[model samples]
Structure formats: C-alpha cells, structure tokens
Target: MESLSCSLFSYPVSKCSSFTRLSRGIVFASRSDSKKHHHKKPHLPKNLRHRRRTELPPDFHPVLHPVPCEGPPSESDSAALPRDYDENDVNDSYDGNVVWESDEIEAISSLFQGRVPQKPGKSSRERPLPLPLPHKIRPLGFPTPKNIIRTHLACSARQPISNQIYKNPAFLISLARDIRSLPPEDNVSKVLDQWSRFLRKGSLSLTVRELGHMGLPDRALHVFCWIQNEPHLFPDDRVLASTVEVLARAHELKMPFDLDKFISLASRSVYEAMVKGFIKGGNLKLAWRLLSAATEGKRMLDPSVYAKLILEIGKNPDKRTLVLPLLEELAKRDDLKLTQQDCTAIMKVCTKLGKFDILEALYNWFKKSGSVPSVVMYTTLIQSRYLENKYRDAMAVVWEMESSNCLLDLPAYRVLIKLFVALNDVSRTGRYFSKLKESGFTPTYDIYRDVIGIYMASGRLAKCKEIRREAEMAGYKVG
Candidate 1:
C-alpha cells in the first residue's frame, strides 16, 4: 500500500474559511509523488492562493499535522509533524465546523412527515437493518455513510420553497404519483395538504402545467382552485396560463379560465392541443365562447386557433353563420387591425344580417389601412349594394374591380350572375353562369333560383328545366 507523510508549514488561513482552524502550521502531505504537485502549490481556494503568509505570533506552535483521510494507516514520515497536538484531531470532522438551527431541522423533518416508521422495535422482518442513527436525522432510504448526511441537510434546509421543489427529483416524482392516483371527484386539497410544506406559487403552477401534459383536467382544475384560496402565493399571468392549458387540453374550456388574463403568457402548443380537441369533439361553440372573451387589445388569437377554425368551416360550411356574433364583436374594436381573411368573414356576416352600414364601414376601414382591397371584399360590397337595390353603385364597384385587375374568386362570379340577372341582361347572366360551373364553383341554392328566374322571364323553358335538373343533381332541394 502507498504510504502517507506530512510536512509542517506555517501559513495564514483566511478568516472566511468554513472549517474551524486547528493550528497555524497545519498542512496536509501528499500520498503519491508526481511533478504535477510541484506546479500547483496546493489545492488552496482561489482567494487564498496569492495571499502571503503573515508573521507567526510569539506563542505560536512550530509544527502541526493534518488529520488523515478515512482508510488504513500505512507508513508515515512522523519526524516531519509534531506529536504535541494529537488531542485536537478529534475535532477535525467537517460537520463540527457549522451548526444547524432548530427551525432548519424542523423544515427537513417535514419532508418525510407521514412516511417515517412510527414504531422501530416491532417488525416482522428485521434481517437487513441499518445502523442506529438518531431517528430525527435518519431519512427514509438513506444508505450512505453517516458522515455525508450533513451535505444532504445543508442542501434541503438552505433553499427557499420555490427552488427546493425544483431541486428534489424524488419530491416532484412523489407529487406526480400521488396526484395521478387520486380519484377525479376527490378533493385535490387533500393531496395538496399532504405536501403543504413545499407549496409555493412556482410549485403550484408547475404542477398544473405537468398535469396538462399528463392529460388530467379534473385534478388540474381542482388544484388551480386551491391556488386561489392560498393567500401567500399570488397567482400571476404565468400561473393563469398554465391553468388555462389544462382545461383547453381536455376540451373543457369555460368561463373560469379567463384566457384574456394572460393573452401572451400561454404558448402555441397549448392552443394547438386545444384546437385538435375541439375538432375531435365535433363542436366549435365551446371554442367560440372562449375566444369571444378576448377584449379589444387582445382581439387576435394564436394563428393555430384560426387555422383550425378555417378547417372546421370548410368541413361544415354552414358553421360560418355561427361566427356572426364573434365577427361583430371584433369589428367594433376599432384599434384592432384585421387581416384580409378577418375582413372577408366580417363582411359575409354583415351581408347575411343585412347590416349594409357595417359592411360599408368594414370596407372603408380596410381601405384606410393602406392595403389594396382584395377581390372578395369588393365582391361582398357589390352584393350588398345589389341587395339594397343600388344598381348604380353595384355597377360602379364592377368597374373598379376591373380597373384593379384582381383575379375574380367564386364569390365575385356569383355576385356578377345575380347582378346581370337582376338587370334583365340574359346574355351576360349566361356568360357568368357558365364560367361558374367551368371554374368548379358549386352554385348555392339561391344562385340556381336567380338563374332559373331570369331564364323563365325571357321565354326559355327548356333552359330553365335543364338548370333545375342540375341543381337537383348537386343535392339542392328545389321548390
């Protein structure tokens, strides 16, 4: 076995050293020989390395030896160290340097509160037992040497609750397991009370977010209620966002989760999960209710939510009528800048409701925003004018659309067909009607009626009957 030795050297120890000083001349000796030791003076802390040693007091001892490491003692150069201070070796352990207060012990003891075994003497199987340390300090599942326990204590009692919860993986794991095992109807406060020692604003929010990821909407909602009742932890925007995520995950969004509370705090991933859940449930009224809560400044939602709205509207075109209230609410928020798509949706609603003034206002708003009006916007305006019997203005919008050189969409083609039919211009009406079919624009029931009416008025029963048959083949119930 390799041998150990010591060499006495007097050096000034820093006042800030954690371990208590034994003697001024105490210095540790190396166990192995290598040139690397010559390069480094010793393992002195950075602050102490460049400091010069101070003069020893007149009464200072000439030599003192370092306490040896824990192992069998091999050969040692005894002549290098003095034997006079051997009695001081008993105080060398690192635990003796600092003291733990009563409050700290109580804080640590709270971690294993109910899990500690109450009665130690009576056990059915006691074959493999541990050494008897004091019951207060012996944590459950402790297997390390007793000397290392102070490190654990220092780690636990030294931090605030917010940081402590994040550091203890065992604590977080136990918390998740306990919450998962709870029944949906049982009070979440019970589980929360069990771990009340570690509760904080950050911990509560983290639990809710994790529950959302685990898909536990019921428990998440319950714990969120507890957060509100607890007076110490002030629930902020981050906390509100996490709670919203839990409900949105299960497609259980409602008024309690006011998303406008933190319009920017929640992430897109949460909204994506919400949109998917809504699509799977085959209902959008719940989603619309939640979105409608968004006030003036927060009028815009995540793009993913709007994309899903478009997808759902495509699958069930009649649902467009359901968005009328939300559209009107958004249109009233003058400060809210809207996209072309938003303009189109609002105009469609305005036309259906015969709100000609609102439609004209929306068109003027978009025009003032420095963006050229889209083909659909102009088309909605033309149809609105024609509905109000403003033939002069309707024809004027057609002239402007042609001057803008914008490609006509399906709505523009239908408006032209209706306008020409109203003017008793059969030739122009037939031209636009053929283009509608060739462009794969499925005509609505109203479009078919207008076309058949114009044909019958001009003495063409053969053409009217053929158009009626086409409408029936396309699944429209003609009267």
Candidate 2:
C-alpha cells in the first residue's frame, strides 16, 4: 500500500515539469486509463519529497486532484468573501478547514477579557483639572494717615498756623482751644487720629510748629530725636522743607540741633525750597553750600528755581557777595535757559562786583545774537559799568538803551546820576540832569545832594549854586 502511495506521488513529482503538456493530453485521453497510468512510478529520491505523504495512510489519497490552473481570481470573486463570520459554524461540513482556522483566530481575539498594560512611561491617572487662582486684594482709595501727616506737615511748614491761630499765651494754655472750637458735628475722632499719627511720625517741624503755637516749644524739643529718627514716608521737597523748618526752629529754641545735618536734609529739597529756606533763615553760606551740592549732584536745577535763587540772592546785600561766583558757575552749564530775569540778575551781580569785563562780554553776546536787552538788563549793565568807574562804557550802555527805546525810568536815572557824580564828570552829570528833568522825573533830594557835592568837590561854586536852586525848584526841602 505504501509502495502504491509513493508511486502515486512520485509519478506526479517526476512529471511535475511536464504537467502543462500532460494536462492537455489527459483531457483527450479516456479517464480509466489515465487513472491507471497516474498510479505508476516511484523511482525518485525520498528526501526531496513532502513529509505529509509519508504521514498519511497508503489508501488515503485525500481525493488528490489538481486544482484548475486558471490563475488568480478577478476582483469580483475576492469582494464576495464574508468580512464577519461565526467561528462555531465555520467548521460545518460544506466549508473548508482553512476558513475555520481564520474565523477561530478572530473570535478568540474578540473575546479578550483583560486590559493591556499601560506603556512603560505613561500613567493611568487622567490630568487633574487646573485650580482657579484667588483674586487680588485692592488697597483703600481714601488717604491714609501718612497722607494726612504729610499734607499737614507741608501746610504748616509753608504757613505756620501757630503764628496766626494761637499766638497768645491764653490760647496756648487752653488744651482744647482749637479742638473744642471745631463744630460738634465734625469728625473729631478722625481729626484726632490724623493729629496723633502726625505726632507719631516724629516730624519735628509739625510737632514744633504745633507745639510752638501751643506755647510748648520745650516739649517740642523733647521729641526732637524722635522726629529726627522717624523714617521719611515721602522724601519730597515739601517734606524736606518741613523737616528743615522744624530743625531750624528747634535750634532757635536753644535745642542742640545739628545745623550741618539740617542743611544736608535741606539740600535734598527742590532748589527753590533750599535757596528760600536758607535765605529766610539768614544763612547765606548754607544756601550757597546747598546750591553747590544741588548743581553738582543733580546736574541741573529748574530754570525758574535757578532764576528765583539768583533774584533772591541779588536783592540781598549780604548774599549778593556770592552772586558773581554763582553766576559764573550757572553760565558754565549749557542746559541752563537764560531768561531776561537771569540776564538782568547776572548783569546786576557783575555790576556790584565791578566785573565790567564779564559784563562787556555778555553785552556783546546779546547784541551779536540780535536779542534786544530789556530795560532792566540794560540798566543793570549801565549801573555795573558806572560802578566800575567806566564812565564811557556806562554812557555807551545808556545810548544803547535809548536807541532800543527802552524807557529809562526813575531807577535808571538815579543810577546814572550816581554813576556820573562818582566819576566827578560835571559836564556829563549836568547833561544827564537835564535829560532826567525832560523825562518828567524830578530829582530827589539825594540826587540834588549828589549833584551839589560833585560840583563843590570840583571847586565849581557857581555849578553848586545852580544845582541847589534846581533842587529847591523841584520841591526838595534843601537845608
């Protein structure tokens, strides 16, 4: 039987190369003889054959037949395969084992009960929802105790209420003088709280001013250190000014207040505040020191503040000594805006200092720039030259003033009369005297006195008598 089976498989294997030709012949041949011939021949090597033939029973041909060789099926046949099939029914008699095997695999996979393990790096926990942020708390819009303290300090320093409200001892002795006088409906607690906070801030100025008005300058000094050590809530000009005034008053009250420290604090204020404070305190030296520090440290002062300082200093007889040097320093700064007031102040300072050389340079600078000097500026220059005994230069400035149509007022005439009289130039003095009268400005007794002195000093008795008569005619009570 094995021999028969081997022969059956061997015949096909040996003729496999000629199967195409044999297939054509078999189609014409009788079926019985073809079957008998197909059962012959087993002479091929065993090792080259398929193992399935050896495992099967000899008689079990398993309906061995060649599948029709029409090649691969068309798309329409492939499309007819069922996508979903029952695994239990796949092995039914009509269907092949091949279909059963594929369907069983899909059914087994669909019945998977356990979850797959997560990837090595990932977590199963879903991302938690983000938490909302808390809202920010806003500050109160109303003024704080600090604001009231600052405002009260600023106002007190600027205009001391003590001097105006509680100047007398009776008002000072009454503890509730102003407090009791306030309307009953007023917020006394708020007012008291503000005052208490102001006191606690250790502002010596406000304390001193308040106490001084209450005739308690002694108690004011007792808390001077507290005021000195208190942290400045607002270190602006107004605050600094208050601090300075407080310290200055403390010093006046016989307290050992540090003048240098006070001046240093004053230096930090605006230039106007520092200058005015020093001037008011009659400390011109400290004013100059603060001015120098301000200019050197801040690099520039406000033009208006600088002008105010210059004007204030120029008007003071003692402080005027510092003007020329200050003006020179001011002129060196290119950023300084030289207004008419500044120019006039500089010219006046130069005249006072007899710095006619600088004045000439300034006048030429103004003229070349085509800027017409105002009456004050021209008069300042003329007065300055006259003070320097430069009669010709002084007269030249007067001519310039007249040409520019800058009216020479009484002050200008007084300056000219004084200048000419100083030079003992009788002819020039007489000429200016006639012009002064023509301008409808009668000479004062001082001017007449100056004219008479100039003529008498030159031994011109007749000219002196004529000046006396003119003085009498001009309503001067000449002795």
lDDT leader: 1
- Candidate 2 residue lDDT tens string, 310-336: 666777677676676676776676665
> What does candidate 1's lDDT look like per residue over 1-479, in tens digits?
21132333422222112222245434432221222222322233333334355422231222334456456544453343344434234243233334333333333443433233234367786787777679756678856766632224356687666456643545654666678887867787778776665665565666776776777777777777777777766554455666765676576875346556544554544444455555445657656654655434454555435435543554455676655555555555546666788667667766776778978887888788898988878888998999999987999888888898888877788788889887898998898788788877788988899999999999999999999999999998777
Q: Model-by-model lDDT, in order?
A: 0.63, 0.53
| Candidate 2 Cα outliers beyond 4 Å, as residue runs | 1-272, 295-298, 303-325, 364-371, 418-435, 438-440, 449-467, 470-479
How high a TM-score does candidate 2 get? 0.41
Least lDDT summed over 10 consecutive residues: which range in candidate 1?
Answer: 29-38
Best by TM-score: 2
Q: Candidates' TM-scores? A: 0.37, 0.41
- In candidate 1, which residue pairs get closer than 3 Å at backbone N, Cα or C atoms, i.e. clash? none
Q: What is the lDDT of residue 413 in candidate 1?
A: 86
Residue 24, candidate 2: alpha-carbon lDDT: 25
